[model samples]
Target: MSIPVNTTAQIWVPARRAADVTARGARLLRMADGCAVFAVGSGTHHFLTRGRPRG
Candidate 1:
């Protein structure tokens, strides 16, 4: 499954800060107060996803 990326930006979250969520597949995540939190990162991988997507 190839997710459409901007390519112009890259996002890289620390392995510790990134949470793995299992649904259909393993997904990286981050949350706060039991609810999803907002985040963005440096580089061409930069992304602002509304929520986790099954990878």
Candidate 2:
């Protein structure tokens, strides 16, 4: 799927597909050891960090 320039707050996918998401332009937020977090756009920051869809 194509991620638009302005991404939404929720993007649910299996953990194994994280790399694919990143390849589609989602911003990698944090990385340590072998784990990473990604944000599709500015509006997703909270969702990425909190592990819950923003209300």
Candidate 3:
């Protein structure tokens, strides 16, 4: 899957991959640490933050 660009820390991920930032928003992506990041894109938030996977 292709990762989206961070516009002023704005994260826009695909639908099926949005789960990657649903909850684990910061953990998944270091840059988004401690920020008001919301799911502004499509996709199922199923696989998102299921388990804390340390990168």
lDDT of 1 by residue, 1-55 (tens): 2335442222232222334322222233445434333332322223233444433
lDDT of 2 at 19: 48
Roughly what TM-score does model 1 have, to 2 decimal places? 0.18
- State which candidate has the highest TM-score: 2
What are the runs in model 1 whose C-alpha is more than 4 Å off?
Answer: 1-22, 36-55
- lDDT by residue for model 3 over 1-55, one digit each (tens)? 2234543233433332335445442334423433324542333233244334333
Model 2 weakest lDDT span, ten residues long: 44-53
Better of 1 and 2 by TM-score: 2
In model 3, which regions exceed 4 Å deviation?
Answer: 1-8, 16-21, 26-55
* lDDT of the candidates, in the order given: 0.33, 0.42, 0.37
Question: For model 2, how does the per-residue alpha-carbon lDDT over 1-55 read when each residue is reduced to its tens digit?
Answer: 3445654433454333334333345556654333455556533232222242222
> Which candidate number maximizes lDDT?
2
RMSD of each: 10.3, 9.7, 10.6
In lDDT terms, how accurate is model 3? 0.37
- Which pairs clash (backbone N, Cα, C closer than 3 Å) in model 1? 9-44, 9-45, 9-46, 10-43, 10-44, 10-45, 10-46, 11-45, 11-46
CA lDDT for candidate 2: 0.42
Clashing pairs in 3: 15-42, 15-43, 19-48
